[model samples]
Target: MKKVVAISIFLIVGLASVQAQKTAKMEFKSETIDYGDIKKGSDGLRVFEVKNVGDAPLIIEDVKSSCGCTVPTKPEEPILPGETGKIEVKYDTNRVGPIRKTVTVYSNSSEPVKALKIKGTVIDRESGS
Candidate 1:
């Protein structure tokens, strides 16, 4: 009886692992983007490129910014296996000074939720000090 139970457990675990192997995966070109130094109110936009490196389709459900100053947008359609997608991030450069923000991406990929980073410095033109 013990042997039978062990076999059943092993079979279940094996099936689960097989299913996980077919799930969608997200592979980003770079997890972090550095804008370096920029003048206030300058173009504060960047794109995070990712690839669907799994056997299934990658569906990005939502993209949330850490604060109001930063905005993130995800692709409208699902990313098929071996395909690529982009996440556009727009930071408000109006607020001068150091910038460090995070964007959380929710998807159906292996990593259901992932955090992306953006950091840089914004200098005010008026302050010219």
Candidate 2:
């Protein structure tokens, strides 16, 4: 009975460790962005901060936007452990009304793909009275 109990506890701890290892070590400050409100025909900028919290280095391969109206920029080099990086997002408000965009990031860490989202409402300019 004692041996069985010890074996069970070992298995449980091992499983927990494995599960934690499978989880992505990379993290982001804010996964989503809310522009809140803006005027039409305007442009906006946002920066997403990322940090490496795992033992391995964090390498961002690329960043892609959902549409041409949105642009994304990121660091060119790899971020060492406990280092920081940035993802710059630009939105062009040509069309009016609410807007939701996504920026996909590819990396060389445990979680190779990371997604960042942005949402906001655009108010059209009032016409001359």
- Local error of candidate 1 at 73, Å? 0.4
Q: Per-residue lDDT for 1-129 in model 1, tens only?
A: 999999999999999999877989999999999988889989999999999999999999999999999999999999999999999999999888888999999999988999999999999888752
User: Clashes in candidate 1: how many?
Assistant: 0
Q: For each candidate in turn, give its C-alpha RMSD to the true structure in angstroms.
A: 4.2, 6.6
CA lDDT, every prediction?
0.94, 0.84
Candidate 2 wrong stretches, greater than 4 Å: 1-24, 127-129
- Candidate with top TM-score is 1
For residues 22-108, what per-residue lDDT tens digits would candidate 2 score against the true structure? 422578999998988888876688899999887767878899999997899988987888888899999987767787989999987
Clashing pairs in 1: none
Scanning candidate 1 in windows of ten residues, the lowest lDDT window is 120-129
Error at 4, model 1, angstroms: 21
